[model samples]
Target: MQARTVFITGASRGIGAALARGLAADGHRVALAARDGDALVELAAETGGLAVPLDVTDGAALPAAVAAAEAALGPIEVLINNAGVSGSAPLARTDDALWARTLAVNLEAPFRLCRAVVPGMVERGFGRVIFIASNAGLTGYAYTSAYCASKHGVIGLCRALAVELARSGVTVNAICPGFVDTPMAQAAVDTIARTTGRDPAQARQALERLSPQRRLIEPAEVVHAVRSLLPEAARGINGHALALDGGQTLY
Candidate 1:
C-alpha cells in the first residue's frame, strides 16, 4: 500500500495502539488520538506518529483534533473510528444516563468524525472509514441492552453512510470483533471475577469460551483485518460488517 495519512482514535492502548504500530510499519503516517495524553505521546514517539490527545465524545474538540492531525500529517486518507466504551447492565437497570453515554461514545462520536472527514475524502475521491465495533452490534447479549443498542446503531450508521458515499470512492465499513485480548477485556474479566467470586483465570476463561475457538482474539488479528481494508482491492467491499469473532455469530 502507498503511504497515506491515517487518523486513529482510542490509540493509547489495546487494539488502537496495535493498529497504529501496524500501519506505521506498513509505511503509513499515523495520528494517534485518545484521552491519555502521556500514553499517546509515548506511542507516537515509538511509531513516529503525531499524538492528538482527545476525548471522542467531545463534539467541540473533534474538528480541532482533525485539523491538528492534518497539519502534522496531511489530509486523513484513512479514518479509524476505534474509540469506544463497554458496559453491561440489565434492561431494568439501564437508565437514561447509561444509554446516552454509551451511544455518545460508541455511535455519535464516530458519526461526528465521519462527518468531519468524509467531505475531504469525497473531494479527493479516495478514503477509507473503518469502525471498530463489537459483536454485540451484530447480535444481542444478556445484561447489555445499552451496549447492544449503541453498537447496533453504529452498524446502522456504517451502512447508511456507505450507500450515500457509494459512488464517491469512499468505503465505510465496520469490523466486529469478539472478546479481543486488551485491557478492556481484562477489566471485564475482573468484573466477572468480582461479581461471581470466580478466580480471575476462571472468569477470563469463561469469557474466552464465548468464541468457538475458546480463546481471546489477539490485537494482531484485529490489526490484520484493518490492514485488509486499506488497499484498492477492498474498494468493492463497502458497507459490510466483517466479523472477526471465530464464528461466534454467523450472521
Candidate 2:
C-alpha cells in the first residue's frame, strides 16, 4: 500500500495520540490536531507526525489546518475524526449551553472535518474516515443526556457519509469504545463517586462491570481497532461501528 497522509483530530492525548503514533509507525505520514499546542508539538516530534494545533470546534481554523497538512504531507488519504467530549448531566438538568457545546465539540466538529477532507478523498478515489464514538451512542447511560445525544448524532453522521461516499472508494465508520482506561474515564469515575457517595474504586469498578467483560479497555486496544478500519481495503467496512468495550453492548 502506498503511504498516505492521515489527519486526526483530538491527537494530543489518549486514543488520538495513540492512533497518531501507531499510524506514523506504520509508514503513513500523520498530522496531529488538537487544542494543546505544546502536547501536539511534543507528540508530533516523538512520532514524526506534523503538529497542527487547533480546536476541532473551531470551524474557521479547520480548512487552514487541513491545507497546512496537505502542504506538508500531500493530500490526506485518511481522516480520523476522533475528537469528542463527554459532558455529563441528567436530562432535566441539561442546559442549552452544555448541550450546544457537547454537540459542537463531538458531533459538529467531526462533520466539518469530514466535509473538508472527503472531497479530496473522493477525488483521490481512496480514503478512510474513522469516528471515535462511544458505547453511550449505542444505548442510554444514566446522567449523560447531552453526551448521549452528541455521540448518537456522530453515529448518524457516519452512516449518512458512508452512503454518500459508497461508490467513491472512501469509507466512513465509527469506533464505539466503552469505559476505556483514560483520564476521561477517571474523571467519570470521580463524578460517579461524588454523585452517588460511593468509593472511587467502587464507582470505577461499577463502570467496568457495565461491560460484559468486566474491565476497562486499554487505549491501545481501541487504537488497534482503528488501525483495521484505516487501511485501503476497509472501504467495505463503511457504516459499521466496532465496539471496543469487550462486548459491553451485546445486550
Candidate 3:
C-alpha cells in the first residue's frame, strides 16, 4: 500500500495507539488526536506522527485540528474515527447529561470530523473513513441504552456517507467489534466488579464469553481490519459494517 496520510482520534492508548504504530510501521504518515496531550506527545514521537491534543467533544475545535493535521502531513487520505465513550446505566437511571455526552463523543463528533475532512477527500477523489463502533450498535445490551444508541448512530452515519460518496471514489465503513481487550473494556470489568461484587477475572470472563470465541478482540485485530479497507481493492466495500467479533453477530 502507498503511504498515505492518516488521521486518527482517541490515539493516546489502546486500539488508537496500536493503530498508529501499525499504520506508521506500514509507512503511512499519521496524525494522532486525543485529550491526553502528554500521551499523544509520547506516541507521536515514537511513531514520528503529529499529535493534536484536544477533546473531540469540542465541536468548535475540530476544523482547526483537521487544518493542523493537513498542514503537518498534507491532506488526510484516511480518517479513522476511533474515539468513543461508553456508559452503562439502567434506562431510568440514565440521565440526560450521560445520554448527550455519549452522543457527542461517539456519534456527533465523528459527524463533525467527517464534515471537516470529507470535502477535501471528495475533491481529491480518494478517501477512507473508518469508524470503530461496537457490537452494541447492531444489538441491544442491558443497562447500556446510551452506549448502544450512540454506536447505532455511528453505523448509521457510516452507511449514509458511504452511499453518498460511492461514486466519488471514497468509501465509508465501520468496524463493529465485541468487547475488545482494551482500557475501555477494563473499565467495564472494573464497573462489573464494583457493582456486582464479582472478581475482576470473573467480570472479564463474562465479557469474553459474550463472543463465541470466548475471548476479547485484540487491538491488532482492529488495526488489521482498518488496514484491510484502505487498499484500492476495498473500494467495493462501501457502506458496510464489518463485524470483528468472532461470530458474535452472525448474518
Candidate 4:
C-alpha cells in the first residue's frame, strides 16, 4: 500500500488509537483527533503523527481541525470516523437532550467530517471513509434506543454516500463490532451493574455472551479490519457494514 495521509477521530484510545498506531506503523502520516489533548499529543509523538485536539460534537471546530490536520499531514487520504458516545435508557426516559447529543456525536460529527474531507478525496480520485459503528447498528437492543438510532443512521449515511461516490473512486464503509473491550464497553458494563443488581463481572459476562464467540472484541481486531479496507484492492468493497461481531448478527 502507498503511504497516505490519514485522519482518525476519537483517537486518544481504544479502537481509534489502535487504528492510528497501525496506520502509522504502515508508513502513513496520521493525524489523531480527540477531546483529550494530552493523550492525543502523547499518541501523536509515539506514532510520529499530528495531534489536533477538538471535540467532534462541536460543528464549528471540525473544519478548523481538518484544516490543521491537512496542513500538518497533507491531504487526508483516509478518514476514520470513530468518535462516538453510548448511553442506555428506556424510550420513556430518553430525553430530548440525550437524543440530540447522541445523534450529534455519533451521526452528525461523522457526517460533517466526511463532508470536510471527501470532496478532496474525490478530486484526487482516491480516498477511504470508514465509520467505526456498532453491532447495535445491525439490530435493535433494549434500553439503547438513542445509540441504536444514531448508529443505524450512520449505516444509512454510509450506503447513501457510497452510491453517490461510486464513480468517484472514494469508497465508504462501516465496521460494526460487538461489545469491544474498550473503555466505552467497560462504561456500559458499569452502567449495567449499577442499574441492575448484577456484579460487574456478571454484567461483563452478559455482554460477552451477546456475541456467539462469548469474548469481547479486541481493539487490534478492529484495527486489522481497518487495515484491510485501506488498500487499493479494497476499492471494490464499498458501502459495506463489515461486521466484526463474531457472528452476533447474521444478516
Tens digits of lDDT, candidate 2, 1-251: 56778999999988898888888888989999999889899999999889998998889999999999999999998888888788788789899999999999999999999889899999989888889999889988888899998999999999999999999999889999998888889989999899899999999998999888889999889888988876666657989977788887887
The digit string of per-residue lDDT tens for model 4 on 155-245 reads 9999999999999999999999998898999998999899898999999998888888889999999999999999999999999998899
- Per-candidate TM equals 0.98, 0.97, 0.98, 0.98
Model 1, 183-245: lDDT tens digits are 999989999999899999999999888998889899999999999999999999999998899
lDDT of each candidate versus the true structure: 0.94, 0.89, 0.94, 0.94
Off by over 4 Å in 4: none
For model 4 the TM-score comes to 0.98
lDDT of 2: 0.89
Per-model clash counts, in order, read 0, 0, 0, 0
Task: For residue 198, give model 2's deviation from the true position in Å.
Answer: 2.3
Superposed by TM-score, candidate 2 places the C-alpha of residue 97 at a distance from the truth, in angstroms, of 1.1
lDDT of 3 by residue, 70-156 (tens): 999999999999999898999999999999999999999999999999999999999999999988999889999999999999999
In candidate 1 the C-alpha lDDT for residue 191 amounts to 90
